[model samples]
Target: MWYYVIPALVIFGVVHVYTKSWLYILLRTWRRDLKALIRFSKVNYYLLKWERRNMTVPKVFVDVAAKHPHKVAFYFEDDIWSFQRVDEYSNRVANFFLSEGYQQGDCVALLLESRPEYVCLWLGLSKIGVKAALINTNLTGDSLVHSIEVASSKALIFGSDFERTLKDIQSKIVHLNKYQFNENMSLSKTLFDNAKDLRVCLKESPIDAVTEHIQKGNLKDHILYIYTSGTTGLPKAAVITNVRYMVMAVGLNKMVNVQDNDCIYDSLPLYHTAGGILGTGQALLCGATIAIRKKFSASNFWKDCVRYRCTIAQYIGETCRYLLATDDNNLVKHSVRAMFGNGLKAQIWKPFAEKFGIKEIYEFYGATESNSNLVNIDSTVGAVGFVPFYAKFLYPVSLVQCDEVTGEPLRDSNGRYTICRQNEPGVLIGKISALRAVNQFTGYADKVATEKKILRNVFSEGDMYFNTGDILMYDDFGYFYFKDRTGDTFRWKGENVSTSEIEAVISDIANLSDAVVYGVEVPGAEGKAGMAAIVDQTRSLDLEQFAEGLRKHLPVYAQPIFIRLVDSVELTGTFKLIKRDLVVEGFNIHVVKDEIFFYDVRTKRFVPLTKELYDLIMQGKVRL
Candidate 1:
């Protein structure tokens, strides 16, 4: 009896230790991968069925509407749009477009604000196999004209709200037919000579389903073209196929456990992939209700969530940081249990969730066109996603060693790309296969642009993979963490420095409202020198305390050599930092209006950057 009892105790001790180890986390992640695959199999079955029937999103939406006709599909400000109403409205749009002689494969440019009609119009156009180019509403002048011309749009459909914007670019876009729809139900004629009133046409059009005239297309057909942010350069139109839309919608819905009863509060612009596809897809594909906001209001975010009784919320870029900076007195107990998006920083994750009473955070990582998508299902603190060692074959995603400067994959003597070891930073790539929807890369509308993203002969003779252009690392637990973008991570003092990591630290130390970090060229520096632009609206930032904090929290090499203080930071529509202009102006006092400072090695403090110092730095007289 003594011998048997001793053996049992020893076994119990071993089991407890195993459960506490990283191996246990890896095992749980494997279980999660298996369960996710099992759930995704259902999506594949429907995709196959839809492909065989040659059905697109509109057809699938019709089936969903039949089951839940009276369900509230969208909540926009003071109005509620029911499934039946949206379905009928979309049918009217389809009929109206058909009457205009718009055939399958024709392209139309859509420039509209965030509203239910945006989704309805796109869905309606998709019915006739006409792909809608969803242009960024914030674009103006040359950028706006280039977006339309790049897509080769035959027609431009815009809301009356953008009439002024259209009038400015009317000369450039005069070749294309234009249609303007009134948001308010008033019968109004278009201001442009070539533009027509789409609202009036829609009112007279039949509301009956245009099933007979629906285009004969499969899941692989292009339905929409969502543009990139254009932060670094001009926006590129990424092709969104029916299958890609469904995959994005279903994959996120199933993994995050979003239900039909959930109401998602989306304040993001409607033209983006996060807002247009993922947010609206919940309502169209999963039968959930979406609450739309024209623009993000950090002060009113929580109030709106409570008002809508939303079960889920969406955010992107620095949205979470802005919310955290807002006054807490306005926040109230609400029904939002989950918050999902891509760019929540690790420093504010736990605090934001706890303060807002959020139960789960589905932090995800993916580009508008890349097939390399990831989501943190279990709410791991800093993890974007997880892929266990044993589950690599199933996921088809790997981290490959690459040149930090150029982001090109490094090949071994075998002429094959080498996989990064655990805890090593590498660029993430997803194997592309035409056979599976999950692994397919639909790519951009430009053939040359699309080809540039595909890395051929990755591991074998003819294997192809989509380069994600993001640097990431996985720990021993198989939890992946986002390091930085390929071009954003610069080397300094023989050490690779991540701009995002430094930005997070600066934001925390200085109590800054916003911060943008980048690398700038110094005359004598071997690599790019670090520079940080911080927003101090009230001019309350204590430089001494900030310097002390940085010294304590960050390594000596990772510290920013130059600092620029601005009243505010310029951001893209999605709240992403616009660094192109800032980077170009880089520590040049003559070009930059903002106050600049530099770290003095002897003084061990930040000192005002005078013209003499700037000249010295440029002449290589001052050591960086």
Candidate 2:
């Protein structure tokens, strides 16, 4: 006993002496790491209880409703719905679907705006094991028909707001049933033969049949079809399972630290995953309220937050810019303390927070179909995801070296992927192994597109991984930052330029609401030349100022050689910048409707693209 005590005392004295020097720093770091680990475990432990039970989104909502019956579940412009009320409404919707001959595994197309009824209708369909194809309400014509056809929907349920678009494509849509929400009985009876008011649909009493049907379904079953933003091409129908929705609900609630009395301010469209699952579904899961807007109004954004008493909000990359563009002084007075979503630009993160008094911004990186998902819980500016060193072994997310041109993972001599070194940009990939349930990539309904996302024989035989098309880089601390989309990165002057990075810079310019950066082929030039299509709201396109800002921020090669100023730029329903049309239109003054300008190297200012300059550029005479 004496020997043991003496040795312990000696060791303690030595440790105390070490604490006086820099050696004490290691212990502090260890303590901080331990705290983070405990916090992560606590959050996951609560979520795991439901994940183990295989609880679906509808089931979770029901549970919350049972717990907080009188609590406000949803808030629209002038309407408020209690949790119990919405739960009963969804039950009526389930009964209505069954009465109309809907069955398990049936597909229904939903074209509606963000409303309390819209959410209840979808949740009701989910109760009866029906997958709702969330079509973009902005879509019409052939695109709308194609989305419905691709989804193989048996029914089309639309809102009265989109009655005109529905009527235009009414004949083209080959669905077994067409139903429209008879809001105020304004929708024409001739347009849609089967029209039912939302109130009339909610007349049926809540029944046990819905709960029993939901209990019969498994976690792996498809719950919804979320379409990708067709910015690069036509949208693909991504299959979302019950388990995935559960993950979104629980995962977001935990990450954002949602409170029971909190109200979420969500202006994003419901058709997208961010607005649908992460926004509304999260609020339902956590027994929190939601303030949904019909459409995103930049001017009314702050006023709505204060009006609804919203403590949380959802946003995309473009959301902050629009809010910042407004001059409304109401931005400072609000209950919004935190926000959760992806696509928040690094340049706007600090300003957006300081201006609006946001305490936390849970920026994230994920797609509708990809299994690779990560969230930045620590509010690190510019970081899309975080991978703590202690959890790195458990997390399968990784960056792999890929071909710059083909955007494919590079194979080694044994046909194995080479992991990207720290601080090097590479395409992010996540392992999909039977050993890990969280890594399952349930992909799209189209088998070909599903297979296209999978990479085989990576790292080991029979190994598979999900390829994320975007490039990312992680620091030694495991903070991941987005570089650019694989296809969006273009080579110019023998160097690669990230379109997203450039767009972020341009988006930071005052009065420039939005920008789309792309590469266009230049005659005799080594590779594609950088071009920008910008939305100038102020109509004060000072060429000297714009060029000066570009020079200060970007390198000569990375700066746009041509600038096209448009009154409005096209965007996907999810608020992502669409560059396909801009890329196709290029800087051709003859074909383009907007004003085009070319960078004058000699004067270091942009000059209007005239016939002589266009000819000079086409003939390789211009230095640009």
Q: TM-scores, in order shown?
A: 0.78, 0.75
Lowest summed lDDT across 10 adjacent residues in model 2 is found at 20-29
Clashes of 1: 0
In the range 318-357, model 2's lDDT, one tens digit per residue, is: 6676677668554458888899887677877898898888
Alpha-carbon local distance difference test for all models:
0.82, 0.77
- Candidate 2 regions exceeding 4 Å error are 1-36, 185-190, 194-209, 229-233, 328-330, 434-437, 488-624
The model with the greatest lDDT is 1
Candidate with top TM-score is: 1
Task: Please report, as a residue range, the 10-residue window in candidate 1 with the lowest summed lDDT.
Answer: 227-236
lDDT of 1 by residue, 287-359 (tens): 9999999989898898899888999999874678778867877777889999899877687889988888889
Candidate 1 local lDDT, residue 265? 98
Query: Which residue pairs show collisions in model 2?
Result: 317-343
| Superposition TM-score, candidate 1 onto the true structure | 0.78
CA displacement after TM-score superposition, residue 124 of candidate 2 (Å): 0.4
Model 2 TM: 0.75
